[model samples]
Target: EAAIGIDDSFYRVGGDSISAIRLLVLCREAGFELRISDLNNTSTIRSQAARALSDDVISAPGTTTQYAPFDSFDEETVQRLKDNVVPGIGLSWDSISDVAPATPLQRGLISETLRSDGGDAYVTWKITSFGSDMDAERLRRSLVQLVGSRSIMRTRFALDPILGVVQVVLKEQVGEELVPAVEYCTSASEVKARATAVSQDQRWGRPQTSPLHIQIISAQGEATSMVWFSHHALHDGWSFSVMEQEWRQLYDADGEKPISTIGVDVPFTNVSRYLAGRDNEDDLNFWKTYLADAEPVRLASGSTSGPPPPDANAQKTITHTTKCDLSSVARACAVPPSTVFLFALATALGLFADSDDISFGLILSGRTLPVDDIARVIGPCINTAICRVRLQQTQSAATALQQLQADLDEINERG
Candidate 1:
């Protein structure tokens, strides 16, 4: 029925991966074993219907007699349903209780906060574009609406009087200055210097404030650069990317887009709730055994100590970028480009550390849970996994790559 006339394209009419999953659930309940891959490849109703009836369709694994129907809802709708939700029933469309568990990552952040000496960690992204029409006032309006609509954008911390643990709190309304903080500089160098200063000097306003901020630099009137600053406690790399994409969409549309389209997001508060209730005994055991005898990473300077205590009042960062044929490396290693990049990164760090035995933390997306529309739950939603790779003096590069691949797969599967 959603197809209207069979020729309609599912995606052209606002159908997305979430809707496709919902359709799959509905069809499965009706005794149709449809392949999700087939649905993704073909957008029209006729093709999907035909594919559904054909032998090419494969049944979804782990069949059950009962399946939730709202599983088909887009990320936004699912998240909206979670806000002020009732407890106990779990992932339903009807109104329910609103208690959520704090996630493991949130717990760690809370621990850091309790220590009181925790330094700030913020992710910064700067975009410079030319020959474009971007209205500052319109962008400001979009930013304001964006902050008001998402709970994570306005989330803050408070001490739970009874438990003594820091509690995540969502405000009913946030009225932060939405206009991008403007800076004027005569040259590009000054612009960069001023932006860095803002990123370093700005804080998330002492516990009871939003962790996200933005600044717009109008440099020389020929180039406009926007710097997005977000505290790591509030967002991860994935969340920042999502926000940037939406920001561009809003700027391009002159803020005419509906809040429903641009602003529906999973609240970090819910993530904290869900994480607080996870059972990770097995995962803990695995890590303990795997890295029982691993030594601390050593640098070429023969110092294994971490970077000098971060200057609380200043920001220091060093970034280097060089491009190469990553796909070629991926092909040689028989792994995806992402894995290849990690392998290369570990190797480079191994050289810097002056040791063949390397161990470092890898960030996971934390979306592989039982929660509905987990991908849309926008907060930190980031978990760290330990990556350990042992290199041999005479081992072939291909062999080392294969070993790294095996280690990564094990960590992922167990985590």
Candidate 2:
């Protein structure tokens, strides 16, 4: 939708910092890589669209004639492989042992696990390009290589009984069960439905074990479809897309491991450790003061003019979209498009609540500081900040937007 106009600026059309990151991910999924800054510099639609198209052409997946099959591992072999351990990849108990505390995010997941029912939070990717030469065994090997190479892919959470802490441990290698691939000769729709069902079924599996799976589907009597599923805790949208591209590269590599230039100076584990040590007093105070008296605009209350519906929970939402000149609005208001949208949302909420003050949580990309190769790190990298907007009944739109921008700027600075 943001690529329609050749002269349009991404920021001017409501693209914020997070949006820039998402655009880069989209480019990566389209078989290309683009820096967030590149999108910022080349804000015009023509430039970005052209670069994306060209990159897709250059990075197109190549056809393969020979590969491994799906039934490469037997029960005994897979069990032995999982029993093996890496020397220095997990918790240590030496005199100089450095204890790695769980980050707040991981702790949150731990709390969820204590609950009776945890949600299925995972991502799935369906692949259609499959040649007859590409067998399950070959795909299994590529997946094994992928898991061994990426730290996040190999990570698992283990509770340290002595320390009373759940520390992340990297397995030496994943077993066949972890990376199982089976042939399913079915239609595309059936394959997708089955894959989704399987992915959701394993959402609550132990994190100490590999939370990834691959299902091979042969559509139209040809073995040409595959589905990849992984737990969301292992990575975000960006990291997942990168992993997808890397898997493709490994599959295409002719009996050789692809050279990995996507170096990570600061791994996800460091970020977790840093967050554990970093002080959040100021952020806490900001949120406390910000939301002290702010009330959420409740859309449902005792204001019904007709009979109650058959099932209140069976509600459906309809979205209407139209192309508006957002660039013009940005220029007129002297604020970014994101701010414009935020102000509009706040205004709508104010009307809904019959008040002019509102507060809500705005999720932000967690990488505020410049961590080397942070973008490439595969893990949960999102944080939520308090967004409080107070507008007068007679306040102009531009004025309200400016005030909102100021509030966000202060929060960013504090964070």
Per-candidate clash tally: 15, 7
* lDDT score, candidate 1, position 319: 100
Off by over 4 Å in 1: 1-102, 107-133, 161-172, 175-205, 213-229, 253-260, 300-326, 341-356, 367-371, 392-400, 413-415
Model 1 residue 346 lDDT score: 77
Lowest summed lDDT window (length 10), candidate 2: 62-71
318-362 in candidate 1: lDDT tens per residue?
899888876566554454455666777778887888777788888
Q: In model 1, what lDDT does residue 6 have? A: 79
Q: What is the lDDT of residue 217 in candidate 1?
A: 66
Off by over 4 Å in 2: 1-15, 19-99, 118-138, 160-165, 175-177, 181-204, 215-221, 224-227, 259-266, 302-323, 331-334, 412-415
| TM-score for each candidate, following the candidate numbering | 0.57, 0.64
The lDDT values for all models are 0.55, 0.57
Cα-based lDDT at residue 128, candidate 2: 44
What is the Cα root-mean-square deviation between model 2 and the actual structure?
11.8
Q: TM-score: which candidate is best?
A: 2
